[model samples]
Target: MRLVHVVTLVSEDGAYGGPTSVATGQLEECATRGHEVTLLSLWRGGSRAPAHIGSVPLRTRPARALLPGRFTGIMHPLLVGDMWRSMGRADVVHIHAGRDLVSLTALAVATLRRKRFFTQTHGMVEPRHRLVARLFDRLYVPLLRRARGCLVLTERERRAVSEVIGPQGPPLLTLPNGVRPEHDAEVERGPRAPEVLFMARLHPRKRPDAFVETAALVHRKLPGVRFTLHGADEGELPTVRRLIAAHRLWGVVSYGGALSYAEALRAQARAAVYVLPSVDEPFPMTVIEALSAGTPVVCTDTCGMADELARRGAAVVTDGSPRAMADAVCEVLTDENRRAGLVRAGRRAVAESFSIHAVADRLEEIYRNL
Candidate 1:
């Protein structure tokens, strides 16, 4: 099968976040299965072409900034042409992120070429502002309706998207993101350090400030514990810095900045606990990486993976509050038996359910049927 993935941005550097990681994982898995996979994405920083995501080909074009602030959309005219040609040669086109121009262009090209395409909303359809919600309902919702199938991370997201697209829209498939199984072996060796990791963009939505506050609280209980904040600074870096200084946790809490994909996996493996304080996280790839590395996790209950992990006894799901997160981290660090149990369960869950091979098998089935 020839598969093409259309996403906003992707780089060999660690500039991108979850969506790119998920796309790359799926593409690599599909390629390993003898499928010809191509990733069509906007190259960040500058124009780069003919890059390889392992064996899979990466074709990218320069991105034109559309808005002033961060998290703004990139306008890539070449994307439409690229998708038109790629879709003509491909068996299936998988579009990621619903509320983006790239996705809208892919849908248009797929329809024009009479090709089968699946659009996966990385949980971006929900709008917090009334004006944005109105725009999505008027414009994006119709484009989503044209997709052959829609993919969502959770049942909650499926329901929310269904409400907007109506009952007559494309079939929605629930597929959580998966991580590479090889990470389990590539993990850092020896005894894990007394470190808690918070790896995601420094955005308010991710609540890096809350992670800092939680770090302060945990430090009070476990003085030896260290907190590391990884990932690129999006918007909350200043706030995190302020909180770190205000709490006088200069050495106890340090920002490691952004790390490459491989580096992040090793970081996860080295840490005692991985923390995600985000709210309404559809599905975090970091959580999957943590579990795959046999590391326990402490995340907010609002996360999409929280319920499943909690049920499996693989993670400590806390309310999205600093104190609650602090307590969860403290418990996981202090109790040896509890930590061991979580590690075992987390590894089992990743192997049995969240491995990329299993996810690719399901995706291939869907693509074939489509």
Candidate 2:
């Protein structure tokens, strides 16, 4: 099978988060299975040429500002041309983002060429603002409807997209993002420290402030607890810094900015508990990585993987609040037996469902049927 994957950005460091990670993992797995795989992405931070993830080929174009907004997608004529050419040669086009301009361009080309294309909405269709939601409904919803199939991380997201696309929208497939199998071995070795770690972009949506508040609450209960916050500052660095100072958590809480992929996996392996306090996170790769490392996870109920993890007894799911998150963390920290059980369950869950090889096999079936 020849597959062409279209995404907004491709970074070795996972600067753009889970979507990039998912794309890289899936393409590599596809290539390993002897399927021809090519990635078309916008290169960030001054990448000149194509890079490879294993045998998969990644072609990128430097990004340029065409739209005016914080989350608005960029434009590159060369990328559009590249995508069009790739689609012409590929058996199927797999688009990774829904609301971006690159996705919109791919949709147009696929429609014009009458090609079969599948779209995976990385939970981008549900905008926070009413005005933006309305804009997406008008402009992006139709593009989604044109796909042969649409993929979502959770059933909740599928239902939401179904509401917008009505009865005649493209069929929605519920597919969770996957983690690399190498992390599974890390689960055997026990955590090196009694640390609670938060790793993601320090942005408003990620709720780094909530993590800080939760840290303070957890520290009040477990005074010896160490909290480490990792990831590059997006826009909420000042807010996180202010909260850390206001709570006087300088000694208890420390910020480790922007980790490499290897550093991140090592951090996950060494941490006792991994927490994601973000709201409406659609299948966070961090959660999967943490689980794969046999580290117990505490995340908000709104996270896409929350239900599945809780069902497997792999994590403690809480409401998106500091008090609730703190309580969940304390529960994991205080009970040695519970923590061990969670670690066991988390490793089992990842091995059975979220491994990249298994996910790629399922995806191959989908592509063949299409």
Candidate 3:
């Protein structure tokens, strides 16, 4: 099958995060299976986008910010030329949709041409009460109803999509993000320096400030222990630095500016524990990556996978409080037997449930059905 993915933005900083990563993973999987796949998205910065993902083609246009600040990732819609000639080649178009230009354009093109398409919102299009969200739902929900399937990560997300689509809409499919399998030669992990890591975009919703606070608490308990923060700044770096300075956490905590995807994997492999202080993180791909790397995880109870992770001894799920997160990280660092158990169980959990091969098989089946 000729599969085409419309991921919104491919900025230099990887500011698009999970949605882009997931879409490319599928694109590479399809390519490996001898299917012709293409990634169509917008790009920014001087470094230049990659030529391809594995063997799949990567086609892009420059992304320009019409509205400034946090809204820059979504470029002006008119920047792209008519891709009807391009969209005409696909058997199916898979949109990593949100209220973004690339996704909307593909939806419009596919609809006008009567082509089959699927949407996976990646927790972006919730039933938000804000004026922007309401306005977007007006345009997006109708296009969603026309899709072959609307993929959601969690049950809450399913309800959110359902509420927006009303009583009748597209077939809502539950498809979790899949991690690519690691070789058996992967490195072993344990308690080490940089005992805790907070890796994700340093945005307000992700609660990077809370991580800083947690670091201060953890430092007070274990003076010699270290904490590291690694991610691109999404308008919150200044605040994070201010908090770190205010708390006098200069030596106890270090900032490792930004990490590439490969760097992130390596960092997780060596770290003792990975913590994401964010609440309502539906399914944290970062935690899964850490688990796959044999590192223990610390996250909030509000995560979609928290119950399962905690039950299976794969992670320590807390109440998202700085105090709670600090306690969890310290425990993971000091408790040898418990830490090993978490590593073993986390790897097991990832292999059993989050493998990319199974997701690829299901996707192929879905494409054929469509």
Q: Which has the greatest lDDT?
A: 1
Model 3 TM-score, 2 decimals: 0.93
Model 1 spans with C-alpha error above 4 angstroms: 12-15, 46-50, 68-72, 127-137
Candidate 3 residues 48-155, lDDT tens each?
Answer: 778875566888877776554354246655534435656688899888888765666678888887889999988887677878667766776788889999889999
Model 1, 316-350: lDDT tens digits are 99997999999999999989999999998998889
User: What lDDT does each candidate get?
Assistant: 0.85, 0.83, 0.81
lDDT of 2 at 272: 83
- What is the per-residue lDDT of model 2 for residues 1-370, given as tens digits with 9 covering 90 to 100? 8889888876545577777778878988888888888998887664455577556798888777788643355868899788878889888889886576777787787777777899887786653457866775676778778888998888778877777778888889877788876765644465368899999998888998899999999998899999999987888889888988999998899988877666788889899899999998978999999988878999998898888888999899999789999998999999899989998999888888898888888898888886
Top-TM-score candidate index: 1
Overall local distance difference test of candidate 2: 0.83
**lDDT score at residue 281, model 1, on the 0-100 scale:** 92
The estimated TM-scores of all candidates read 0.94, 0.91, 0.93
lDDT pick, better of 1 and 2: 1
